[model samples]
Target: MTEPQVRRVRLEEGFEVQAYIYGEGDETLFLANGGPGLPSLYLREPHARLARDGWRVVAWDQLGCGASDRPQDPALWALERYVAEAEQVRAALDLGPVHLLGHSWGTWLFTEYCLTHPEQVKSCILADGACDIPHLVGELDRLRSALGAETLAMMRRHEAEGSIDHPEYQAAITILNYRHVCRLQAWPDSLTAALADWNMGPYGEMQGPNEFTYTGNMKDWNRIPAMGAIAAPCLVLCGAHDELTPACSEKMHAALPNSWLKIFEASSHMPFHEEPEAYFPAVRAFLEEVAARAAVGGLTRKSHPCR
Candidate 1:
C-alpha cells in the first residue's frame, strides 16, 4: 500500500494546520483526535488502513497540538473553536459531506460539530468517547478507587496542587493511562512518539494538571441531551475494557436515532491499535454500507434543535 502524503493547509486566521492524506477515493474520511489539543498523528495508522481500503483519509493535528500552531492563549482551547477548526479543515480540503471518526476527546468536538452542521456530515463514528463529563469523571473515580486508597490519595494530592510535572505524578498518570487508556504495558511507538511531542502547554491550561482532574472548561460539559440532534448514521464503538466504559457508549447509541454500538471484546481505549484486526474490518464494513446507502439516496438526516 502507498504511504500517506503529509500536507499543510492555511485556515482563516492564517494558521497553518498539518494533515496526512492517503489513497484516492470518492469517500473522504476525517479523523479527529481527542485531546482537544492533541495532535492528529496518533490517528495515522487507522487512516492508513482506511486509505488502503479505497477511502481517502485525512488526519490533522488540532490548532494547539502536534504540527499545528500552538497559541499560548487559552481561548484557543474552547470546544466551539475546535468545531470551527474542523469545519474549516473540511472546507479547505474540499471534503464536503464527509465521514467523521473521532476518538476520545475528538469525539466530543465531532459530536458538537455534527449537531451544528448535520448537513455537512454523511456519517460519524465515535470511538471510546463519552457523552457526559460527569460520567467520565465517575469512570476516573472508579479507576482511582480500584487502584487502592494509598495510590488514590497520592494522585489526589498532586492533582489538587497542580503538580503533575512531578515525577511521582507522572508515574501515576502513566499507570492510569496505560491501564485504561491504551492497556499496553508500554505505549506503542506511534503513540509514544506523539506523546513525546505533545504540547502540554494547552493541556495544562485546559485539561487540568492531569487526565483525572477536570477543572477545565469541559468539566461540566455534557452533550447527552444533544445526541438526539445528530442526524447522521453513527457507529459508537467502545472497548470492552475501556475506561470510558461501554455503558456510556451504549447510552449514546440509544439516544442517537440512527446509531449502532460495537464493543471490541479484548481492547481497551484504543481499539484501533489494540485490536486492529477486528477494528479495521468493522469500520471498513460500516463505511462501505454507509457509502452504498448514500449512493442509493437512502441515507437522509433530519434537522434537530442544535442545528
Candidate 2:
C-alpha cells in the first residue's frame, strides 16, 4: 500500500487538523469518518487503498481528534460547526465537488453538508449510517433486547447506576459489538487503534456513552423529511447485522431522491473490514457510475437510481 501524504489544515478559531491525501487524480473521494470523535486512521487506511484505482482519496481528523488540535471549548462540537469545518477543509484543499463518503456519525454530517452545499458534492456514500437517530436508537434497543430479559435487566441496572464500565455491562456490550459492530472475531488493527485513542468529548455530548445508547443531544434528530431534496447521486451501504441496522439504510434510501442501496448480507457495521472483497467493489462501482455520469455532461435527479 502507498503511504498517504499528510498535511495540517487550519480551521476556524485557529484549530488545525491533520489531513491525509492518497493517489493523484482529477476526481476525489473525500472521507468523513464516524465517531464525531475518532481519528481518520481507521477509515483512512482501508479506503486509501482505493486510490490505486486512479482517484484521489482524502481524509482528515476532525477538530478534536487524531493529530488535530484539541481545543477544550465545548462550543466547538456542534454539528453545524463541523459542517462548516468540512467545507473549510475541502475549500482549503481545493477539491472540487468531491465524492463524499461518510461512515457512522459522519453520515449525519455529510448528509447535511450535501443538502446545504449541493454544488460542492458530486456523490455521497452513507456507509453503515442512518439519518434518523430516534429510529436508530430503537433499532439498537431491538438488538440489545435479544440478550434476553435477565441480561437486559442487568444492563439497565448498570446504566441507571452510571456503572456502564462494570464488567457485566461491558461484557454484554461486547457480545453485541461482535455481532453487529464488526462481526469479525478479531478487529482490524487500524480500527482497534482508532477506538483505543478515541476522544469521547463530542461523542458523549452528541451521541452518548456507547453505541447502543442514545442519551446525547442528537437523540431526537431526524433528517428523513429533508432527504428527498438531496440531488447528489448517493449510495447507501450497510451490513445486515450492522449496529445501525439495514432498516435505517432502507429508510434513508427511500427518502433520498437520487440514490442506490446495497446491503451486505453476511457482514456488519464495518463491512469494509469484515467483507472488503465485496465492500470495495460496490464502492468502486458506484464511483465509476458517478464518474461515467459526470462525463456525459452531469448527473440529474431524472437519472435512474441504482439498487
Model 2 Cα lDDT, one tens digit per residue, 31-89 = 99999899989999999888889999999999989999988887788888999999999
The best candidate by TM-score is 2
Highest-lDDT candidate:
2
All candidates: TM-score:
0.92, 0.97
Clashing pairs in 1: 34-105, 34-106
Model 1's alpha-carbon lDDT is 0.81
Overall local distance difference test of candidate 2: 0.91
Candidate 1 structure quality by residue, lDDT tens digits, 97-183: 899999988888899999989999999999999889888888778877887889889888876786767887678777777878887
Q: Give the TM-score of candidate 2.
A: 0.97
Give the per-residue Cα lDDT of candidate 1 at 4: 74
lDDT of each: 0.81, 0.91
